[model samples]
Target: MSDVGDRNGGNDLVRFEGVTKRFDVAKPALDAITGAVRGGEITGLVGPDGAGKTTLIRLMTGLMLPESGTVQVLGFDTRKDPAAIQAGIGYMPQRFGLYEDLSVQENLDLYADLRGLPRHERAATFDELLAFTDLKRFTSRLAGKLSGGMKQKLGLACALLKKPKLLLLDEPGVGVDPISRRDLWKMVENLTEEGIGVVWSTAYLEEAEACDRVFLLSEGKLLFSGEPKDLTARAAGRVFRVSGIPGRRRQMLTKLLDEDGVVDGVIQGDAIRLVTVKDRETRFSAAGDAEVTAAEPRFEDAFIDMLGGGPGGRSRLAETQRSFTVEGEKPVIEARALTKRFGDFTAADNITFDIPRGQIFGLLGPNGAGKSTTFKMLCGLLKPTNGEGRIAGFDLRRDTAEARNRLGYMAQKFSLYGDLSVSQNLQFFAGVYGLHGAHKRERVDLMTSIFDFRSRQSMSAKVLPLGLKQRLALACAVMHEPEVLFLDEPTSGVDPITRREFWTHINGLVEKGVTVLVTTHFMDEAEYCDRISLIYRGRSIALGSPDELKARVANAENPDPTMEDAFIALIQASEEERMAA
Candidate 1:
């Protein structure tokens, strides 16, 4: 990383004083927010969807001005000196604009030209950036063809071409796997050594925990601002791990979450991690035969607590769901020898799995690792070269329509009609799912009530917040109440509370005999699965429950292995074996 210039005498690189930004909505995107970013340190803009993180980041870049207060970037007020702020900062928006058809080198050259790098200096700068991002070997490759991780690296490279004093990254880690996220963090941390101030806006609390300071936002309000450790300290002595329940962690967690003193709970490996109300740690001892022990607090625990705790109790949607049943004890969803090839390049190689009724099966892998291929094949969106995908005993290829009708699919991205209102989208989906007249009206009403979409029912689907959009997509998918559900990264960029709410609904559905097949980048979500198939380079690498998978990678050096640890280790072992072969 190149040193931009001499560090500012003062540590504060950016300052927000009573910053308030509003759009057409009733509530301001950022309401009277006050914060500061210091040089040589990372400041995290942490929040749920529509929490004003993006709006705050945009203000820092001078792309937008606040309505009430001033945003000063590098000692220049954004309103007065937007051009100067733009010139002296590197801003990577959520979707970095990279010309898809252009080669990697060409894109870099374009960004260099746009940033006004002199012709003589372009070569050295390009070389340095390519080496730093490890994209030198793929310079000739088209930007569109690069993997998700590589594309992010290229975007970062483009932003760094001018080596501005401040770097603004808005959810850059979205959709990227854990390995790629780690690499991106390492790259940014190295740049901070040269005194570049970074404002990282993210939904992942783990990323927030690594930041030197964090400003937590919720519903356009600043909830907290300080070092991550200080926030985590708030949840100390409140977190606990309840174990000794085999094959019943989720059940216990659901119950505990609804208990009087329990604030939040989740299934963690073979145990249920709980965070109790402050000063209510000694409420109870045993949960049936289970043992409760105090566990270390994490940033997520603190984050959820600050967000008024998770949306507890059973899912309203699940409660309204009718029971589903299949005869003969056959697997509800099956993938037999699934394989897909594009011009001799295997996207999925002989993958196979069977999900019993009511089971939550997870498909996990790094970006471009073929989990999507497997998912699409099962959904009947893509044709497999050789294999049979069965949904509720209906063959995907042979009985395509029958198979599709029995399943509901929530895609990775929000696939709802952007121009349509929430009610209109739900009605359309109900019709498509074969409901009619009174039945359609009933289902739509149920969805609106269950997902709490009545207030914003007339709002365009595109205008809703990320969390609401996700809820709408899910509502549309499950409105018909299919026997099987396929969720493709349903909680990719949402906050921890939103994720918990999603899982609560999903778990409730499972309890009512709804089989689920899901793909996710978040390791915590993977732990909720009854079993996971870890895919890499178009092949299944590890197949087991969350606990079983963690045990596989556990040792004295790291006796307690997280799902991410197990995932990375298994992938590394597979790569080494392939290289040896």
Candidate 2:
């Protein structure tokens, strides 16, 4: 509500005058949007899926023309002075525009040259950018070979090569680990110190707090714009956290969240954080429950409150501890002392874990933690150099087909043909998985409806947005409805609303007795699984409920460590143990 203006006393670096961008059928992405970007500050755009955050970034960067209004970057008209803006500003899309075939250094060099940095200055620019993004050590590695976090760093490096006055970042923190995100935020802070205005867009509400100012968007309209602390302070002392017995915790939270007084409740590992407008926090406490400590409202809580309550709010939180329960059967999948090596490097070493029937299991880890290799072995795509395994009661090494037939996997990149329509891709996968004719059609139809894929059937897989692409991939992966579904980071780079929608479909599948083994870098998504197995450096270091794993690695020094902190501490301890040994 309060306009802080530029702190550095410079002219407004970027100003949008009733900016409006439109498509043929859908509503205008930015509906008469007018905003100012001040120099020497970081402004964040926060919103749900399809809320025009990316569209706003594209318009500012001159990637698209506003249908009616005008967008100005660095005082230059977006439509008239497009070349000037393109020359002076850096932009990173939700998808990093890196060339997969090129090495990281080469990608940076390509962007440097494209931005017209001279030969002599190019070297210094490349070195400085690499240092800023902390990717100097991996400069020569192929961009495709790098992990998700590394790729994100590389993308930022490429964008920063020329020292643009205005920087536009679109969802830069999505899928990155918390430490990396924190580092990235620090880098943004430094850039603002140098008088470079940054307009950042992200789906994670917590990230919006670091910006000097935040603009909340919903359905292409600005809902609120102010300092995040001020906005959240409006509901301060209205939220509290409760931790106690699991059953009782869920019961109290559900009743409070559903009752008339409570505004919202978020399940944050071993605690149910509730928000109410009533101001009195003690009214909801029951016997045997831990004290409800007054807490600040998280970005997620504010966003959820803004949206009211979506479906499955309580049920989703309750399923946080969903464990695999198989009647009269051993585990359907097992990996014992698994060791995988590539040349002299070991991807997986002495790793062991088990998957039971009809369970939603998770692989939680940082980048390069051997999750991909372990996933490969479980799906029978790769053979282990040492150790033994089984899938669906079939020997993984011997009965590869028997194991493969029972398992369906969705790779990290979503191995669908992008050129084909959604329906065509589904048909192809249905046939590949042995479904034919009427049965194949029925399965495809069911998947389309299940994932809300009806409207985008005719659109090419490549043309569909990030959320639609996920739905299409999920549809293809489950065409045959295999007993076990292995999804590798299925929700990476997706928005919060779409991520919730994606998980809703996943929850439904879990209800149908389908076993799911998913790997994700997202700590929040890790909380949604029935049970999680945290893998680090090729070993299952901790496996249990999200709260249980966090408790196992619980630092008494930081008693309220989040799932992200627990994961980092766990890996740090393991790394220390390995070094000492």
Candidate 3:
């Protein structure tokens, strides 16, 4: 056969030709994929859920083989030289690959030993890796004791221990704070200086901008591949923003989309941005005029447009309704001076907040912030060391079951059974939530259709990609459509396209007047919440609307300001003020 098993000659570190991976009788997970990753540059593979991002990485890492076609890594046939490729490439999965019970230094030592490094060189290698990851001080701490960001950094450090020529990082910044993400990128840049090639897959399009080249995939096929600048150039003159009352934005967008020449429109809070491929047509109205203006198309806007159009139908209608609040409604959740301590550590110290009925209140902060502790207290999963809290007006300490019953909670990890198929997992969750008969079946069907779970319903939970796993978790949590929803890092590791879709579903739930309490590290997502409490070091340092907080931080005499910068500045200011006190 024409040396099909032979390696290709090039500066390319990895290559795939007509690669296809079939898990079942249906369409393959990776369909005839063809691509290459060159040395000394960063390549990003961008896609939504079920786009085969993980499958592609697995093939390259030699963890999985293609049913057809060939995969080449570092000038070796992946199939014939799978062991060699595995030895030469560093792969970090979405999940932390470290042994949780091991200490930071021990984890690094294990990885170094597993990679077959000489015992004499391990000490120097470990020290260098720890310095690069900035985990030198925490060497003796248990791996599980580290925060999410620290764990990710340690995982990366372990992956880089052997000095592999190629690195495969899958969603390394999923739940990491913006500052930590910035630091992680710096580490990647340092790796590039050593002439190491990187193939990184991420859900965040904004992060993709840092890559030398981008590969956009959809449903197991490559849609576009080139520089981030090229993608933005193609979207020029097509994007415009419309700001007004929030309630009317969706209606205006739908009306505009129905009109001739309007390509696509997106509802961004109080504004609707329209993307048009053709020349602009202005339909001026005294009430609300359609303005043709120029603005940059975000990767999210482009991804949604590329997937056909933004969400529509009953979901769109639900987004327009602001009737989540009842007349003279009482707060669904209330916290009073909640405090939690672990030995000398104050996890949540005197935290307090009130979530009004039908409102979505975001709990936001960086890793090591008390957001998770506060969330646990609210859900009755953890009892506060002092003070009190109530959920659905039920005392968290007294009426725990009553409070839990009225709420739907989704944790950061996939909390479903991996062996079970999608439908089964949903049914299992429904049962656990005490649903029965037609009530359960009807709600299950509704969730499946609403979240587009029907196509993947037969697939096992283990087989679904990160995005689908997130969707399933959301669907299960909302099966009964509880009055209050608790989403903890709901879109942490999901791709940009899936994140937008998840938000569309959340907006629909909010229309039904469901109260939402969410904790997230994604600042961009914080903008969607009605109000936010920014917690850090076991306390709430700032609580207000996102814009209000931004304005306050901006007016603080900072040199340059943006929301991201403002958050960093405000947090640093808070720490300084506390120190002074």
Please report the candidate that would top lDDT against the real structure.
1
Candidate 3 Cα misplacement greater than 4 A, ranges: 1-10, 246-272, 277-293, 316-324, 419-421, 431-434, 452-462, 555-562, 576-581
lDDT of 3: 0.79
Q: After superposition, how far is residue 216 of candidate 2 from its true place, in Å?
A: 2.1
Taking all chains together, each candidate's TM-score versus the true structure is: 0.96, 0.86, 0.89
lDDT of 1 by residue, 1-581 (tens): 12222232367888888988889578888889887888889999898788888888888888888899888788788889899888889988888589989999999989988999999999999999999999999999999998888999999999999998899999989888999999999999998998899999898888999999999999899999999999999999999888888555666677777788888888886778888889864554337767878899999998999888888857888888888755458898899999999997999999989999988999999999999999999999999999889998888889999999999999998899999999999999999999998989999999999889988989999989889999999999998988899999999888888899999999888888899999999999998999999999999999999999999999999999999899999999999999999
lDDT of 2 at 487: 93
lDDT of 2 by residue, 329-429 (tens): 78877879988999998889887778767667888887788888988988888899999888878898889988888777888886789899988998899
Candidate 2 residue 456 C-alpha distance from true site, Å = 2.8
Q: What is the C-alpha lDDT profile of model 3 across 59-162, one tens digit per residue?
A: 99887999999988888787788898888888899888899999998898888888898899988988888888999999999998899889999999988888
Report the Cα lDDT for candidate 2. Answer: 0.76
For each candidate in turn, give its C-alpha RMSD to the true structure in angstroms: 2.1, 4.5, 4.0
Error of 1 at 126 (Å): 1.4
Between prediction 1 and prediction 2, which has the larger TM-score?
Answer: 1
